[model samples]
Target: MESPLKNFAEVARKFCAWAETQPVSTENEVKTAIELLANLSSAILATSNLGFGEDLEGERISDEEWRVTYNRFGFLPFNYYSTFFNPANVGKEEPVIGDLADDLADIYRDLKAGFWLYDRGHVKEAVWEWRQSFQTHWGRHATGALYALHAWSTNESIQL
Candidate 1:
């Protein structure tokens, strides 16, 4: 059987491949991509929640041990969001680590709007708006956006 970490990595790779093919100009395609991204994000969070193996005593290990375990399992490398998103790093300074986190937040905002629209029975409009927002906000670092999109899609399917 595959481990949760391995499953999460596989799903992430699938999402990235799908995102690359998503149509930036089409409303429906973008909406679908966003939904897929949301689902992918949820899966990653779930996997992370599983935590690394614990000792028989069930004590939490140090950060270094956790990192080593995660890395050894072929998980995606970690990055600090604070280092990437801090504005001070943009001009004369270097960018912080949380840049991807910032982008993910933007994607989440758009996804929330889309979710509200769908909840309000305005699926068509919601889809259109999400596509527009995605076009405006999506960048080379599309991981977060994709995760949000996947979550949205999966949730909708479950509801139906």
Candidate 2:
């Protein structure tokens, strides 16, 4: 079975290749490609939360469930909104998972900004933002980050 990262990379690569072969004069194709790129970013951002899975009964656990579990286990930064929203918990523990969650949110926001720039024909700015997003959070994995970097470098629709 292929990893989700591999799947995302393959799809992104194919989209870039398709975008390059498309005529820039075709507004519809360009729009479609840009949308696909945005969707790709969203997919990657969503996958950043690595550990939740559905139960045997097919019920998925809520974020609160996982948050509380992590908190009970003495995980640092136990102030996740789903579990504890108290302001007092702010400086308690410095859990790496919590930090990663924050990074995941930033990834989504940056991806949206990049896609908007691309849609508006600011390709260079879009590429720069996308590159920034990847650089900021890419340390979590080897393959996914490398593939994303390759896609960014080779995609003509992405300037800079």
Candidate 3:
């Protein structure tokens, strides 16, 4: 059987490669978004079993670098959406505005950081980076973006 880490690495690499290309058409972008998000969602689940490693001090992405990727996702149909703190208190609690582009950009940055470590032969550090970021950051963005993308893809009449 293939190692879980290896499996995750493959998915993460594929997602980064696709994001790098910056798909042009609206239809292609939507389809790719759904596919990538679904695959990433599944791949991330495997990281729970990965052991923690010492931080390798991977490079941080600057705001300028982030905006480059964020802007590349400009073609996403749905940019903004409403998010609730608790589903049961949806009406009582104020909904926060979520951006699909922000989610994609953030996820990309997080994964890219791990990539930097992984490519440099720091496999354990790479796994640690992925798992830690998944818990603290990108995981939330991924779920939110996946939910929005799924909704948009399923319903043709859903307006932006």
For lDDT, the strongest prediction is 3
Q: Mark the regions of model 3 whose C-alpha exceeds 4 Å error after superposition.
A: 88-91, 157-160
**Can you give the lDDT of residue 150 in candidate 2?**
36
Q: Rank the candidates by TM-score, best first.
A: 3, 1, 2
Name the 10 consecutive residues with the lowest summed lDDT in model 1: 50-59
Candidates 2 and 3 compared: the better one by lDDT is 3
Across 33-80, the per-residue lDDT of candidate 3 in tens digits comes to 877888787887876544757657667678998898898887788799
| Model 1 spans with C-alpha error above 4 angstroms | 1-77, 80-98, 139-160
Clashing pairs in 2: 76-95, 77-93
Question: What TM-score would each prediction reach against the true structure?
Answer: 0.32, 0.28, 0.89
After superposition, the stretches of candidate 2 with alpha carbons farther than 4 Å from their true spots are 1-101, 137-160
Q: Candidate 2, residue 52: CA error in Å? A: 38
Model 1 accuracy (lDDT, Cα): 0.43
Stretch of 10 with least lDDT, candidate 2: 75-84
Q: Model 1, 61: alpha-carbon shift in Å?
A: 35
* Residue 21 alpha-carbon offset, candidate 3, angstroms: 1.3
Error of 1 at 104 (Å): 1.7
The residue-by-residue lDDT of candidate 2 on 1-160, one tens digit each, is: 7655445445455544443342344334334434554556654554333332221121223456444433332221222222222325687844332332232223334444545555565545544554545556432322232234334345645432
Candidate 1 RMSD computed on C-alpha atoms after optimal superposition onto the true structure: 17.4
